[model samples]
Target chain A: MRFQKLKRFSCFVFYSIFKTKMVKKLASKNNKIELGLLENSSFKALLNSKYQFSKKIVIVDENTQELCWPFLLTTFEELKEAEVIVLPTGEENKVMEVCFQVWGAFTNYQVQRNDLIINLGGGVVTDMGGFIASVFKRGVDFINIPTTLLAMVDASVGGKTGINLDVHKNQLGVFSNPELTICDASFLATLPEKEMISGKAEIIKHALINSRSFFDELTQYLEGVPNDEILAKAIQIKADIVDQDFREQGERKKLNFGHTIGHSIEGLLLHNKIEVTHGECVAWGMLVEAYISHEVATLPKNELQEIEQLIRGQYETLAINDTIFDSLIQLMKHDKKNNSDKINFTLLQKIGLAKINYQLEEDVILRALNHVFGQ
Target chain B: MRFQKLKRFSCFVFYSIFKTKMVKKLASKNNKIELGLLENSSFKALLNSKYQFSKKIVIVDENTQELCWPFLLTTFEELKEAEVIVLPTGEENKVMEVCFQVWGAFTNYQVQRNDLIINLGGGVVTDMGGFIASVFKRGVDFINIPTTLLAMVDASVGGKTGINLDVHKNQLGVFSNPELTICDASFLATLPEKEMISGKAEIIKHALINSRSFFDELTQYLEGVPNDEILAKAIQIKADIVDQDFREQGERKKLNFGHTIGHSIEGLLLHNKIEVTHGECVAWGMLVEAYISHEVATLPKNELQEIEQLIRGQYETLAINDTIFDSLIQLMKHDKKNNSDKINFTLLQKIGLAKINYQLEEDVILRALNHVFGQ
Candidate 1:
């Protein structure tokens, strides 16, 4: 027992030293870069030390404000005095009108440049709130306390914040990073099962591109893991990718795995006011697009089958006619991709490997759609 | 005649060498950190160079969309294909609804990440348009083509963009600078005289704080030089100050000059839906606040007279009552300068100097109000 205790103590010390060196290296790499993600097994200490904000932080949504404040009140202890802005919830509220309300709150609260805004909801809250702070007084610091799984894995990490313009999604925005993100998975417990599934899609994308082992681990543990562990690992996957590509200048585009078609589908569904979660539509999108990759780009039939099988296993497949598929393709063309006119896809060469310019043929997309809808 | 030519050549050569050295030194200083300013300059060049975007850009406003689009089309030489997203004029249209419409145009036109949003109109268009760009797909670059005097002087510079909430001014926002701000004084020729007064107020504020010579020059030339050179210099004053404190950390607060009460009064006037322009209300706010500064801080009687004489000489002053004054003071407390309970003022020590922590007793404010009211 004495020998074991001594060995554990030495291991702990060594681990601490290793972590310090790693964090210092990371800090150096991301100097003057606000939008950054930190990933590691034991990053709790480093996170706690880094985010030292004063008392005037504002939480920008009603549901998230209620759910997140008490814990943040305890964690940042100093943040107990922070004002809660609490605008209405959902994508409908992610409008320029809501941004006005947020700006008013900062003025009403006399938010200073050094002050912080804590965005404590899903993508809408994180994106809009971060955008508000970014332009509020030029730009004030903000932290993302993301609740939903999608935000934890995708929205919260990147510095993409903005409201929708016209019928488009994220048609207006700047790439501005928050000062820190305190993502405690406890927030995920309050999320709906559908939301969890939506988040898992992004996690699955990450695993496919970066770690086959992680994919296996996810497949194994996804059945019935504790919420805390699931959330932690999911966030860890996103953080790892973000750390590698702080901006979407390179590998970060891979993280948009399902998003290309996902966003187009989202815009279409939103315009129609159809009842569909962002993730659900994106899941279907990934499945169909993956089929496109298989048929057009000559991706191995085995890889294509696996992709379809996994997506079908995870989500409820939706049937679409040619009209819908054509409209979807048109939407993709309108995407930030197709600079002049070339359909770009961030596709997997194999599990754990991805490339951005792997163009798929039009016939392949049609075939994939047929496969998905049983035409 | 020969001597004159020789002298001119020598002067030109000396100026060229000096200009080279100055550019090198300025480049070095600005290389570390600095600011850029321009008057009615072509943003097309800067934004195109920065992001390698297409030269064809579109400017949008209800009125200008009709008037300016022709010129923009001719300039970019893409009238055949360039897309324009026009929205209604006025502060009411500066909402999320309009932002959506703008993004819709962007998506429909297949606008890329490197695409530009040229804000054409007053502060409303610049603020909302910039806010839209700041948040779209994370963010896209933007340029301010301020068609109103108010936008050219204050709104276009300092990278401040936001939309207003109900009964609040600039409630939602992010502080993101445009790649270039094209502030053409020729645009001012189209502006109503009321808007010109607003621009003059900001120029006066700039002169009051930093440059006595510029202040003197403006006092002499306020009604004379409504041209590019003066407009460029006014923009330069703001740009230089913003470069010193882009985030409004310390010295930048002095730029508030009269904006503390000025903004509140503007909000009040806007709430009441009065005919007063923004600058007119700020002029009154400055008068009241200056009187308060004189009474409380012993702001040298002669200098106080000069302030009163300067504003009174240039602009019309309304007979504000005690009740109105009392309410205005209450609004001032809600200003960002107030820390919890204490109201802070960026009071003028003399014509060219500002002191931020000029705490005044309540009774003194009352006395100043009475003096301004001519009670």
Candidate 2:
């Protein structure tokens, strides 16, 4: 037993180091969607050297238009001529209706295929802008300048661009990479504490799925906010996984460790017209899913307790009763990740190890939810 | 001068033969999207060997549901258990509302990612179905069983899938290819003569852009209907162009020879509630664009006359007055093909030799329109 434990520990260490090295290598080589530290000179150089857009359009929400747009315009002088298109703030506006209005705006402005659209906001702006650019005249080139921490580390790093359909998150979308993703951490300075915590949920997810050391490092920032280095590392981890599987055909699905249940809870809340940040729901989801991982995938008890405690301490546990469990399960079955009637999940085998395409029985799921709710 | 003419003739012969050989080689090697005859044995064999769909859904219009779906069911035993989704026939129904309904149907049927959606109708069905499949759960594999000549020769062969936005035709769409496109000339038996003529416009455009000999062959079918061989060759011509430039960056713009003015006229008619076929507009477009080719690109007057005469002989000329010209030019300026303010055109330097991204003066275009109108 001692030898077996030692062998497992060695394997984990080797795998973690190898993964970190691989991610660093990929981050250096990745030119398809460059995730760069937002600097005026670099941004100007990128636009002049790479893109030859006839016209530039900036898409932002009301919040970003007020908070981030001024700073962005000042930082990038090339954007002075760019037309500003403002959308309403929040996830509720991330729908087909908003896309229709945005498409109409493009038509009104006569946005050509060669012109560039700069998405300057959080997940909603980037996701909707990417979708708009992708479908407009079959496609147009666009760059994402994520102003929110959640978007910078997770949403904007991945090429998965989409808008919500009805209540389902990212139900209507395309796998289209941006020309560039400028991750300016300075934008996070003005973000609310809730928003910071929301972003941290994804960062925590990245660490739990890929690196135990990273998770330990993240725990240090649990009482505070993460620095630029930590944020860049999380982004690099996601970029590496995406590089391996852009379409989520294999290893990329590990990113969805918390998203499946998280999305369900988010969708249910959205459908009910309840206001909740994406990260809080994901925090709740990780707690419950971690429990399932412990029971089904043999996740170590100590690690499970640690994960549960960390997530629960950050976010309030949602009251998942029998009725809510039934609805949540129904939402899970409707997930795009599922095959036929089976609900596939990305479960944790242990900290820093993820098992993708894991299927569990309905009773087990219900029991997990019951445990999460302290039933 | 005589020696120069002889040399030109030799070059034409050599180029024509080489192009044909190249196209044939490409056709044989293209495994991503197979183009085959829709015989019972071949269709049955294709389904069995190539795809392993759990559930099959047949997307058809009311017109094709009656005319073609029964024939399709008899041809493939695998489609015996397929669900029928009947959409309303016509270009008017190609919108987001219909797509919303179709997506709802997919959800209701629990259509999985691995399941198949066989588009078994004309351009509207194939185009709309392809769009639906591409967007549903990011994408689902689909096959095109084009029931109309327009669809078989043009729409089904290319990966361009779209639905119209309000009055703008194909305003919202994606460049997503189908798994296979089965072109059964047998479906042409039930097609009306007008629809056959409409399909011939694209074939004529294909010939004008690629081969003079093919144009000569097409003229023979102007007085009468074409056979399966002629239809297959037209499809092959389009397929070759699409294979080279799937995104319309360079060589593929040649395919839009008559479409600039053609789409404008079609859009205007649709907007004004004046019903006109896509082929008739394209036929008129060919006459005007051919005139432009003669004036700007130094196309031989004799060759230009030949094109105008042949097209005018088959389709009746639509009366274009000064009032319509303004709207037509305005629409042309808004074309997705245009870069900035310039109205870009694909003019012909000579027959079987298309010059893409050619710009013509406004007066020249107006003169060409006047000439076509016999003003």
User: For residues B170-218, could you state the per-residue lDDT of candidate 2 as single tens digits?
Assistant: 8889998887777755566667788888888988998999899999988
TM-score, B chain, candidate 1? Answer: 0.81
Write model 1 residue lDDT over A176-203, tens digit each, in one string: 7776665544455556787888877877
True contacts kept of 1: 0.57
Q: Model 1, B82-174: lDDT tens per residue?
A: 566677877666666666666666666666766666677788888888887776666666777777777777787887787765545665567
In TM-score terms, candidate 2 sits at 0.91
Error of 1 at A39 (Å): 19
Cα RMSD, each candidate: 8.6, 10.2
Off by over 4 Å in 2: A1-37, A49-53, B1-36, B40-46, B49-53
- Candidate DockQ values, in order, are 0.36, 0.55
lDDT of 2 at B77: 82
Q: lDDT of all predictions, in order shown?
A: 0.65, 0.80
